[model samples]
Target: MILAVVGGKGGVGKSTVAFGVAAELDAVCVDADLGMADLPERRGPDLHDVLAGRAAAVEAVDESGPVDLLPCGRTLAGARASDPRALRAALSAVEAEYGRVVVDCPAGLGRDSGAALAAADACLLVTTAERAAVADALRTRELARALDAGLVGVVVDFAEETGPLRGRFGAPATALPESEAVRRATRHGLPVGEVAPESVVAERLEEVAALVQRSTRSV
Candidate 1:
């Protein structure tokens, strides 16, 4: 299955959640944010190369990381050269080889974000408690529905009040409190599970992952 981790607004810890869920699912996480790749930077043929037709999608996956990742190029030139429309095929190829893929989509309602949603079998929305963030997430949810990607779950970052979100999103909502361990793990491009397995943040991530798994199965 291909799961797209999407947040309409940036800086909501979407990439961190994507990486953590990928780690829990033992799936390859694809940094589909071509313009602003947030996951780890690795040395090899990245998503940019794959989308630019310079490399095979499977060949660009970096397995040396804590979690397998298909990193994206950081250069603006590379991003420009990449075809957003090719993302679906590339993701499909990766899923074929790896069995599962978690895509960290770029923020907003742009073509890049749309492409990721279009390619995904289902999506998990990530947002914050702020009204603006929730509004944007609502817009994202509409986009995902339009693209035919089932909304499996929602992750509310740095917030403990999940009951309202569950009703608003009509999906299971998991709260991820702000944590130094998560911050430190993200700074090093490692999943919280790897950085602090015994921490509360890690336990919450596991819950988020389980919610996604069950939701997707029903889908």
Candidate 2:
């Protein structure tokens, strides 16, 4: 399964949610945000290299971290040289080898984000409780539908209340409340389950993961 974790804008804890879900699923998380890679970095050929034809997709995966990741190069030249069209094949290759894959998609409704959603079997929308963020997520949901990527679930990060979000996106929504433990885990490139397994945030993330898994199975 290839699942794309996406947000309508940046800084909505999209990468954190992607990493957490990947960890829970035991899948390889690809940093598809070529221009602004937010996941942990490693010394090896990355997604940019794979997209640019310098390395194979399976060879670019780095398993040294808490989550297996196909990190992206943090260079403007690399991002420019990489082809977004190649992402579909690259993600397929990873899925064939890894069994399951999670993509940390670039923010917005641009070509890069479209490429990720187009290649995914399904997607999980990540957003905050703010009105503007929710609005953007609604727009993203439409794009995902247009691209044929099924929307399995939604994750509301740092949510104060989830009452308004339910049934808004045509998918079940899970709220992750504000927590210092989650913040620290994200800062260190670790999942909340690994850093604070007993915390409320960790349990909520697990629930979110389970929700996604169940939704995918039914699809």
Error of model 1, residue 120, in angstroms? 0.6
Model 2 bad stretches (over 4 Å): none
RMSD of each: 1.1, 1.1
Q: What is the number of backbone collisions in each predicted candidate, taken in the order shown?
A: 0, 0
lDDT of each: 0.93, 0.92
lDDT of 2 by residue, 96-156 (tens): 9998999999999999999999999999999998999999999999999999999999999
Off by over 4 Å in 1: none
Q: Give the TM-score of candidate 1.
A: 0.97
What lDDT does candidate 1 reach at residue 97?
Answer: 98
